[model samples]
Target: MADQDTDPRLRWLKPLVIGLSVVFVALIMALIVGLITGVPQRRAEAAKQTAKPVPANLSPAFAEQVLNLPRNSRVADVFASGERIIVRVRLADGTERLFALHSQTLQPIGQLTIQVEK
Candidate 1:
C-alpha cells in the first residue's frame, strides 16, 4: 500500500497557507498606507501652529492700526530699514499713500508717494 503521508492531498494545509499569505499582504499594505498618510498631516498641523501669530517686535502699533482699517484697506506693501519702515496704504478712495515710520516707535519718519495706480 502507498504511504498516506507521501500522498499530495494535504487539503487543509493549502487553504491555511493561502489565507495566512493574504492576511500578511493586507497587513503590509495597511502599514504602508498609514505611514504615507501620517507625514503630511503632521507637517500641516505644525505649519498652522507656526503661522498663527506674528512676532510683537516687528510692529505692534502698526499691526493694531491696520486691524482697524476697513477690511479692504490693506498694506499695499512694506519696505524696512534698520531705523525706519516704509508702508504703502491703499485707501478706500482707490488712491494709495506712502508713510515712512520710525521702526522703534511706529511713528512717522517721512511720507512720499511712490506711484498711483488707477
Candidate 2:
C-alpha cells in the first residue's frame, strides 16, 4: 500500500527535477553570452560619451586668426559650437560682450552686448 502511494509521487518528482535543471542551464548560458558580448558594447559607449567631438567645419587657419578686443577689455570665456565660435569679453566699464565668429574662416559673424537695465 505504501509502495503504491510513493510510486505516484516519485513519477512526477523525476520530471519536475529534470525540467528545473534544464531551465537553470539555460539561464546560465544566457548569462555567459550576455557577459561576453554586452561588456564590450557598454565600454565602447562609455568611451564615446567621454570623448570630445571635433567640429566638421573646423579649419587649420583658425589657429592663425587674430581677434581684436576693445581697449581695457579681457576675455571671459570661449566656446565652440557646430559652425561658430563664441567669445565672451568683459570690458573695463564692467559691461559684458559676446562675439560670434565663423568656425572655418574665423570671421566675425555677430556681436552682442549684455546690459542690465537699472
Candidate 3:
C-alpha cells in the first residue's frame, strides 16, 4: 500500500541492490579463479615433493663384470645394507660370488667367494 514507487525512503535501495549484486559476482569469480589456479599448482607441488622408487629388476649390465661370468645377467636378490646391495652371482667356474652392489648405482662394491681344498 501507499505506492512503493513514490516512497522517498526507498529511493537509495536500487543502487544498493545493484552494488551488492556486483560484489557477489566479483566474489564468485575470485573463488573460481583461485580454484582453477591453486588446485593444479598444489597437485604439481605434491608430485614434486615425493621421490620415485627404483625398479626392482635392474639390468645385469649395470652390475660390475667379473671373470668367467655371463653378460646381461639378471639381478638376483639385492640385499641392501645402508648403501650397498649384496648381489649373488653364479660364475661359470662353478663358484658362487657374493658381490656387494651399491644401492644407488647397482655397481659391485666387493666380491666374496668361498674356496674349499680338494
TM-score each candidate.
0.34, 0.52, 0.36
lDDT of 2 by residue, 14-93 (tens): 67899999999999999999999999999999999988665666555867888899999999999999878999999998
For candidate 1, write residues 15-116 as lDDT tens digits: 799999999999999999988999899999999987745458655565554322445766888999877788888877777767887766586666665456
Name the candidate, 1 or 3, with the larger TM-score value. Answer: 3
User: Where is model 3 more than 4 Å wrong at Cα?
Assistant: 1-4, 50-118
RMSDs, each prediction? Answer: 10.0, 5.9, 11.4
Most lDDT-accurate candidate: 2
TM-score ranking, high to low: 2, 3, 1
Query: Candidate 3 lDDT (Cα, whole model)?
Result: 0.70
Model 2: lDDT equals 0.89
- lDDT scores in order: 0.73, 0.89, 0.70
